[model samples]
Target: MSYSSHADEDDDVEIEEEYLGDYASVRSIVKEALPFQILATIGGAVAGFIFAGMTNELEMIPGLIVIAPAVLGMRGNISCTLGSRLGSAIHMGLITKIENNPELTNNIYGSLLLGLIMSIALGIIGHTMTVLLGFESAGILALTSIAVLAGVSSGIILSVIAVLLALGMFRFGFDPDNVVTPSIATIGDIVSMLMLFLSAKVVLML
Candidate 1:
């Protein structure tokens, strides 16, 4: 009814509007980020398929069918998991060097160590499976074991790389969400396959 009262009401409304605007922006960011992450994951899987064709000529059918999936899955899974975990840590404002967060550093190290153990185990399993199937590959078991171990080691290395990249990107004013997951997953796929080959070579030489 009075001019001052009307002015006061207008000021209150503007404050509410600003708050709502901030809330909406936050929600939009969440909505956009989640879908982007999902889409990136699917795209990474597709890329793996396309790259498998390049290696298909190497071992032919069985190589593409068995070896490709094993290497690809192991790398992708490990890298993606580690990347996601690191990203979450950054999001929670818990990112510090080992000197700062020894627990975090040790946890990541332990995970990588476990990966190595799994790699050895998987190698044994791969070799045993091949033998059980009556495949005439004498030193295949040893080769398989080494290959998996090598892959695990490679995965561990890549996990470290991913963490470094994510931290650096965050420090350089980039979103870890956009920087870490996709890049790491793609790199992991390629590196895992490469390590698989290297492991096979090492075992063959032994």
Candidate 2:
């Protein structure tokens, strides 16, 4: 009888956790995503302000803003995917620790490589579209160089943050999958914008 009582208590606790974590209904779905949305909105506003302050940089490197959205989106997508993968790994018991794991290392490497290729492609596309639309372009080489530099740098930073944040949240008994997407979107926006502006400055000097 004692064993049966304990089992019932455990089942109740599990049910409560499921209710809190899962989107079984509208209230639960909002509960899961609301905080992240609030944070993401604030981050996006900050990013817009940062972009506004880059007027000088914009003039120095024409058409850079055209690729800003692409850069931010790419970073967010990669980081979100990494977070989701790590969360799954944690739940599946594949990763008990964050450090010294081959899986984590390989994931980081793959994200970086993908970012590099996208950076080059975005640069070319941005330049081509700018010229085709009769807008001033800083040239294919300059735009491509900036994208590669900024994309690689932001990708490295964001990949680490994604892994660490997801692991930390999972350890704390929070739903990393629920939180990672919005959290990464916010962080990725800020980091990608900062890296892009800095890269533009560096490319200007070259």
Candidate 3:
């Protein structure tokens, strides 16, 4: 009876330690997150540059501006979620190495498909809003086509990059969660914006 009571007490103490971490644990967490924060800042700057660079494309494509923010935000949101899932998979040891992995492929495919569908929907919504707001906008067909093309191309490229980054971090014996945020924000933003404008250029041919 006394032994069982001591075991229970020990379990309670461990739970407390887990929740109320000591100073070293807190310091370690901050140290780990600091680098990611810096990288995220750099990503924000790059995203800003992309935003500025798209001014001409936006002007050239009548309805491009309407869907621009949605496209940019959608990429980050989806890719970030994908990266987080991958990070969890890595921690769970469900994924080993970066190649010849069926699990990785499925996750990538799902994220891509989701992004593609959202892109088409966003294009339609943007086109509708633009027309209703009394703004001169491109035809629905043109806008929707641009969104589908851009979203697919960017999704494929970013999925590859995301998997590589997630696996790379784990292979190097580091936590992917530590930096996936910045990776998704930075690289995803750049690629998505570039594809958006490039698709617009092709569709508008202006």
RMSD of each: 6.4, 3.9, 3.0
Provide the lowest-lDDT 10-residue window in model 2: 20-29
| lDDT scores in order | 0.65, 0.87, 0.83
Number of the top candidate by TM-score? Answer: 2
TM-score head-to-head 1 vs 3, winner: 3
lDDT of 1: 0.65
Model 1 poorest ten-residue lDDT run: 56-65
Q: Which candidate achieves the best lDDT against the true structure? A: 2
**C-alpha TM-score for every candidate:** 0.65, 0.86, 0.85
Clashes of each: 0, 0, 0
Give the TM-score comparing model 1 with the true structure, all chains together.
Answer: 0.65
User: Clash pairs of candidate 1?
Assistant: none
